[model samples]
Target: MSSRKAEPREYHGAAGGFGSLQGIARIELKERAGPGAAETLYRQNKPEGHMCTSCAWAKPPNPHLAEFCENGAKATLWDLTSERCTPEWISRHTVTELRERSGYELEMRGRLTEPMRYDAGTDRYVRASWDEAFAAIGAELHRLDPKSVTFYASGKAALEPSYLYAVFARAYGHNNLPDSSNMCHETTSVGLKKVVGSPVGTCTLQDLDHCDAIFYLGQNPGTNSPRLLRPLMQAAKRGCKIITFNPLREKGLLEFIDPQDPVAMLTQKPTKMSHMYMQVKPGGDIAALMGVIKRVLEIDDEAKEKGLARTLDDAFLAEHTHGFDALRHTVENTGWDAIEANSGIARADLERAGDVYAGAKNVIGIYGMGLTQHVHGSQAIGMLVNLLLLNGNIGRQGAGCTPIRGHSNVQGQRTVGITEKTKLAPVEKYRELLDLETPEEDGHTTVEFLEALLDGSNKGFIGLGGNLAQAVPDHERVHRAWGEMELTVHIATKLNKTHLMPGKSSWILPCLVRAEEDMQASGRQTVTMEDSFSHIYGSIGKRKPASEQLKSETAIVAGLAKATLAHRETRNPKLAWDEWTGDYARIRDLIAHTFPDEFHDMNGRMNQPGGFYRGNGAHDRIWKTDSGKAEFTDPTVLNACGIGEADGRFHLVTVRSNDQFNTTVYGHSDRLRGLEGTRMMVMINPDDMERHGLADGDLVTLIGDAEDDMERTVRGLKVTPYRLPDGCLAGYFPELNPLVPLWYHDKLSKTPASKGIPVRIVKE
Candidate 1:
């Protein structure tokens, strides 16, 4: 018989709709015995006697009764599932077999039970002892030039482990450290650092409560950062004006009927959100922001002329900022006609938004990847910062810039010095403290690392976490790079595509998950994580370790360092790898000494119930620049390459569904968007569809204009007719990553052009 082609399910409007019904059926089917196989495919990663680690780590009696969000619950459920994938199972299966499975299927296959190494000769992975794996990895490191090795860390690991990895890499004489941050929030760091002298956001989650007006630009906090919704809902209830600016009208931004709210649940009424909404086209945020700024300036000028009051905070600007004249000239030169045409927003709407911002005593601006994924993303952020500076809205009680981070500890990972360009002063200080030689040269970023891999310059890779191939754009290029590596080591809790990359010598080292107990040399240890709000909190495992064989990421790093760094004893007498495993406090002490301003007296701070705030420019409106003020940068041309016109093509913007997080696909469904059990769909406006002779549920192929040969055929895709702009089209990422060339990244940040890819669509 021929292989069965899966038929697409049609949408049905119901509380438990067609998609939900199908999901229920799939769940039931998986629970039933099939031949000799296990009844259920889904299993948690935690061992027996699992508890809430986050609750224990929380201050005092804990901030709330429940310390987890819906996504966090899902994350924990997967972490503590009763599933196992032994090394013997992998030994029986070839790499080709594993590659054929879906990403979800591979992940649900189970936890890594033992350390395993890829055997190139047999084309299978074989069991390798932890000691043997570490020794092999160390040997490879010793063989290669320090600069030839790249250390890519993920946000999964605890604070101690990440810090240890950073020290190990620097001691090994290479700063080639490209982390998960390189792909997500690198633009925020780059933009903020240049303007305000800090890479982190200035506001705390508590600030959301006090703001009179909150401007959400280019972000979907409901799906991306659900924890933020509670506060937003509370603010909205208290009559705070919430304004949203994005290309898509996200369901979360519309209104949320909080399941936790008993009154609302009983009444069956949802709180309304977004007093005003504006949908700007892709790459149009800069012009929109500039329009608002220009409106604010005009308002201030009018007030000054009428002798009503000085709307411009001239005193604050003069003392706390620079480059105002150049900024003024640029804004003055930009015509309203150009701004309206480019932004797809009328002058009146932008004027109203500016009025809302100007009228509020305390306002906050929150943004996400939609504002940072373009070629001019950094510039857009700078413009936002400049606007905030003009109003003197930062460093106050309820006002600041907030960049929503993706990963749990993404901000913390970068905070502890994970970067290609390691600041020389800090490295020297660390060297002096540890009595070790510091590497002089800077490291390679994700883009440069890929180039190095392609050219056979970088031979080995140690990915602390994340599926590099799936997460990075232009995955084919990443796949080829993985094939060229001599050694590929993945320290993770579960199996991922990056582990199956098959290097000359590859090892998958099973490590303790975040929700599992991390018993180092220290008894009952805890890890620190910095949230997007800049609040530092402690996290301990709620459950027992998955297996005794599994080690903490800290121990693994120490073992690898011991094996790789030959002259460790000469560095310092206190540098005892064995002793270091016993106590994470010592690591904290080292961190405190290194980042005195941030982590001073770690024990004292951790003992407190609620974690203390890290230092941001919020205490005083002091900018950390060469001129000791916020610098306003104004480029001559907004877009080096002008607005992408739709001659015979549509501008494609890659997006994530409500269910997905980064590259980790929990399920192939988006509950809010009405997409069920399928990711192969594109959202386009009715006008665009009418123009192309397409209807709902029509299969189409997208052809890239960058090159003639680049194209992707997506069949049986439901073309959801929505109120999207005529020239714009939206689709999910990774699958659409093929449409974006690696060479099409932003010139300044080297971030992939994921948001805006010029492509023509046709019926298949």
Candidate 2:
């Protein structure tokens, strides 16, 4: 054999700092082909090129642009790889065999070329044709009650594809559409909608630049949303005060050097990030936020007593709000002792933070999953908005609420109506537009959708995109339910474990990668994506499709509709499937007619480089609540159940490593924290380690009860002691996703309890 050895795993240096963390040994967590494997994976996936043509955010000229952040680059490379999951390949490897592989390795294998069906005897998948697959799906739908089918749409889908998916499901006579948003930012939507009329954020990117102060709660933009760093740096350069509150000391929140800045990168200089950092315990956001608001109220009262112009915007509040007396009573009656104890922050610190907000001329509050993945996440977000309204921060230039979103187009997916609960006007307008009957009943949420599948109430599933099996909590239960489906359809660019959970008749339809041009009868087509700032932009692919067999998401949806719903005239009379092929204009026309104020002349606007911004409540200081004002919620004592032991167990908070994003595992490298090639490590405080007789690099096992009876154990994890809270330990998600029970979700939003899972760790 040749003497050329495999290359060692590569470390990309600290994510933000000029140098890596000191004292910590450079630990290669696994024996993967280091950073070279990343490049190899990229070349394999992108036989055509490394750039993503589908994302407007992708940098120009350089196909593998540095504009691609670590996670984005990983996603792009994984999609364009040269691997293939052909029928023959599946026949050789059983479901059990595939299950044994890590999620990262399995997905890295290649694209799913042909439609497939599950074979019980062989315990493997076999090839099937598009006609046969669609016929089987249609037959199943025809046999079952409409409610028996649950349609799921992932953020990976384009607007046209998602709209068609929703239309098809509604026309088929069911409203069981449970989507990815139900598990992520459902709380943001529910809380914001109740307070602001619109479920989306009230601030744009421009607001960040002009804001005097920014309060960041429960969000880590560095890992989940790296692209947001540019704007954040710009805001910091303009002398904005950024205050961050979280359970762990996130490196990204401290300082960052823009990778795009040649001078800064070359000189190894970094921009200062958070002006004030407060370590709030898990599930402590509500109390912490409440404490800040109480301080603000006291300060305003003091200002009034001193005859200084009242700190409170009295004129604005009197003109725009209601429920002030009730709100005032609740805030004043609450004790400072309880706030300090529950929030784990000192009274002085809370006052200082509040003073910062009160002194600022304009302020914006930004948050993410940290606030939404808890039992009282919705209530926590509500408190943030209430604080903003106290100072008349709404309907202003630099002041509003911004919720940083995960997934490139997660916000856009919701914009196109991939919701479990359909609004009446949108449904009625769609019906009038298409001349079809719209389903009125609200569909299932993610939790309910899975339950329906487990109980055999739902027989068919159609996933527009996403790794549902891995993304959902309680993997054992979700995987079992997924295996029992009658028919399953996945439109995707690559293979994941979700695709392997074969239904009786499963179809893994290959779709064009985001970087590839979507060609149609009309000509080359462009798609629209809504960024976190609510700005819509046009994205046209610059690369060719990996193969002629691969189709655009739009084409696939249109094709599926033509194949299944073509026979039904009443449900789809105005729907000439051909007209929608590669023509996003028609879709825009429909969207414009439905949401006239926001999407007016959407096609005409697409020609402009930077698309228009969606109107937000920040412009008019108008709160959309029933009282027409933001209301304060009393801090309530919250309790979590099903944690087995009261002592010796800590809340195992699942977080995204610096290199990864959401459920998509780009690689096993956390450059900012100096972890490489492995994710089976947990961060613990050194003091806690000494008390537990644990040491650095000690092999341990994490055991936890997902439900009352169901338990999960992850073994052979390396312990890495750090500066986490006394009763808290940190681990990466998807790997630890099994420990989170599906039933243990936020009561209001139905989001997985990934942030506060109680578990016991012991020496293996």
TM-score, structure 2 vs. true: 0.90
Candidate 1 ranges beyond 4 A from true positions:
1-62, 567-574, 635-643, 707-718
Error of 1 at 361 (Å): 0.9
Per-residue lDDT of candidate 1, residues 1-764 (tens digit)? 11332232222232222333344344335323222211111211111112221111112224444433444445554555566778877788899788887777877766788899999988889998998998888888888888988899876665677788888888788898888777767888887778877787877666776898888888876556655666778888998888888888776677766655567666656667788889888777888888888998899989988988666789988888889889988898899999988788899999998898888888888888877777777887888887787877788878889888877777777777777886723686576688766787788888788888878898899988788877776666568678678888888878888787878988999888766667764587777766676666666664666677898888888898888875334555545667767888888888788888888987667534446666786446667777788877785445322236758777778888655667666677776666666778788877777777777777888777665464444444567666666688888876677677666666566767677777778787
Which 10-residue window of candidate 2 scores lowest in summed lDDT?
21-30
Clashes of each: 15, 14
| Most accurate candidate by lDDT | 1
**How many angstroms is residue 173 displaced in model 1 relative to the true structure, after the best TM-score fit?**
1.5
Candidate closest to the true structure, highest TM-score: 1
Q: What is the TM-score of each candidate against the true structure?
A: 0.91, 0.90
* lDDT for each candidate structure: 0.72, 0.71
> Which regions of candidate 2 fall more than 4 Å away from where they truly are?
1-68, 567-571, 638-645, 705-707
